[model samples]
Target: MDTWWLLAIPVIFGLGWIARGFDLKELLSESARLPRSYFNGLNFLLNEQPDRAIEAFIEVVKLDPETIELHFALGNLFRRRGEMERAIRLHRNLLERADLPVEFRDQALFALAQDYLRAGLLDRAESAFKSLADTPHADQAAGFLAEVYQLQSEWQLSIDALQRSGADTPAKSRTIAHLYCELAEAAIEHKDLKAARERLAQARAADAALLRIVQIEISIAAAEQAWARIVELADQTLAEHPEFAPQVVEAYIDAAQHVAFSAPGQRPLDTQLRSWFDASPNDALAAVIIKRLEAAGSMSAALEFARVALQRLPRLSQAHALLRLRAAMQGDGDEDLAHITQMMNGMLRSQKRHECRNCGFRAQRFFWQCPGCKQWDTLPYAASPVGP
Candidate 1:
């Protein structure tokens, strides 16, 4: 029995050696079967030369028409390089193949849709995205569809697409509310106040506490001459969201003045302005209050306010305000003050730019939506406390 066991072990070893030899030969044959361009493409890709790699891969695809994944890769490369027409053609060719796998067909369709989107063919892109419904790419398709609708200014369609996207998040809610706000603004433009109110109601329902909702409501009330409602909203904004005080201050003062004219006993504009400044002290608010006093012919009050503002914040803007106030009170013969004020004004112009909170894009005027990132409610007041 021992002799038989020794002979069986050598036999097993011999068979194993022969099997390994066959595997080695098979690997070598497969390596030889791949064209040289395939290796060249891989080398170029590894070296990060995408343009040369694309040419090499194109040769490989021509030599081997059945290389499905290479076609997809080439299509993606073309699209990324802004060659949308080439990508569209390649993906369309892939979809035309009767023997293509179901998964590859879906991928080809999605790729074609993206090509159309990037090419600015909105109608074709919308149709293609709609066709992807119930497929694995449906969620992504819905998002792209909404973007298309947004670019086209089809607010209702965009809202509908966003709802179908099923991404229930705070950002999505805000985007929907902004869409409703867009509709509201349009309604207001056409003098359809009733429709504007309805759209604003929908916007509030989407985001009950959005600051922009209150702002739009103020606008609607102003249009309707509802002075009392405007005053209330302005107060609510200042008390509840003090961080946005700068943007709302002018509107609040305007509404307050209107209310005071009608009722004759509403809080004085100067008092309300001073109260807001005390809560959220900034050079802009101080400037507004000073202007109000000057408008009322209270030169003494304006000079005092400007002096107090300069003491609190020793910025060039405050100095300029004080210089102007003193000149106005003392009969305007101070050439040095005028020259200094002019120099400060030149410097302040550059600093008085509103910046986007999301992307840091600066603009001379305020924007609800950032022009850089297309984000809504991103621009805060100018970083400087005082500017035109």
Candidate 2:
């Protein structure tokens, strides 16, 4: 009886080991079946059935907790749907796993950062993005950081982030210059002329062809009463960028007013204004020249300048200037002046101001960048008149 019991105990132990092996096989088969659910979820996603897809994916995640790809997919789907909290949860869960591979860990972190950004949690987003700044995703994160800084009006932080991220691409060079201009404008507003000058210099260095920087520099010189510097910069600016000459014509006139010339009888101002008027024939400049000539006791020269400008452009403003010069010279009464004024008003009604060629945005005031489309160097100086 003792020998029989010992033999039974050995057989019972062997059977128990076999049963445990079968249970292990069953678990393996169940886990293998989980991949089919994943495929089904992917197919549903491809068919644009998110509800059904999420159901299948959730089932798969329950069965196989280590599937990072499904988590990523679900996280991205939630983000696209604007369910940012859910997206953050899914990504945060993935990030918490110590067994996750390095690449997947980075991807989850990036997705989490995106969730924070979309949720307007900028502080959280900034922290999340800072971690990825030196990774493969650094460029995109840096760009987002720049935008965030801009939204916060933290110009210095934006500039610093852009510099760190290699922000100056060939396509974005103009934008970078504009960013510097914004900095300079803010500095000027705060009465920080030194800082403003530094920023303006940076802008010019970034894009020599940017005409707005030249305009700013001219204004700065005018404010400082640096007459010779103004003349030198204005002449260089006009020679380099004649398309913007009309905009800066007043500045040039102001600079000319400051310069002291020899020969008391010499009409130096008239000579300078006439040279510019002849070269450009711009209506705005011609008006300024007309006013200056009248002041210098050269009414005939002033009228001639207005006539030349009107003949060239046929603009209402130029014609008005011409009529005013004529009335002043002839000592006309209200009758003649009133008739010319009416005619000038009709011409003004017919004229259009500057238009943005890129976006078809029209405005009376010139913008270096189009407010409509935010495009740089898009607003043309010329107007598009209706019916010829």
Against the true structure, whose TM-score is highest? 1
Deviation from native of the Cα of residue 2 in model 1, angstroms: 30
For model 1, residues 185-256, the per-residue Cα lDDT tens digits are: 999889899999999999998988778788888888888888789888887777766656677777777777
Q: C-alpha displacement of 108 in model 1, angstroms? A: 2.7
The TM-scores of all predictions, comma-separated, are 0.74, 0.57
- The total number of steric clashes, by the backbone 3 Å criterion, in model 1 comes to 0
Q: Which runs in model 2 stand beyond 4 Å of their true positions?
A: 1-154, 160-167, 263-267, 324-343, 346-352, 381-388
How good is model 1 by TM-score?
A: 0.74
lDDT of 2 by residue, 44-89 (tens): 9899999889889888888889877778888888888888988998
For candidate 1, the 10 contiguous residues with the lowest summed lDDT are 379-388
Model 2 TM-score?
0.57
Find the candidate with the highest lDDT and give its number. Answer: 1
**Residue 335 lDDT in candidate 2:** 75
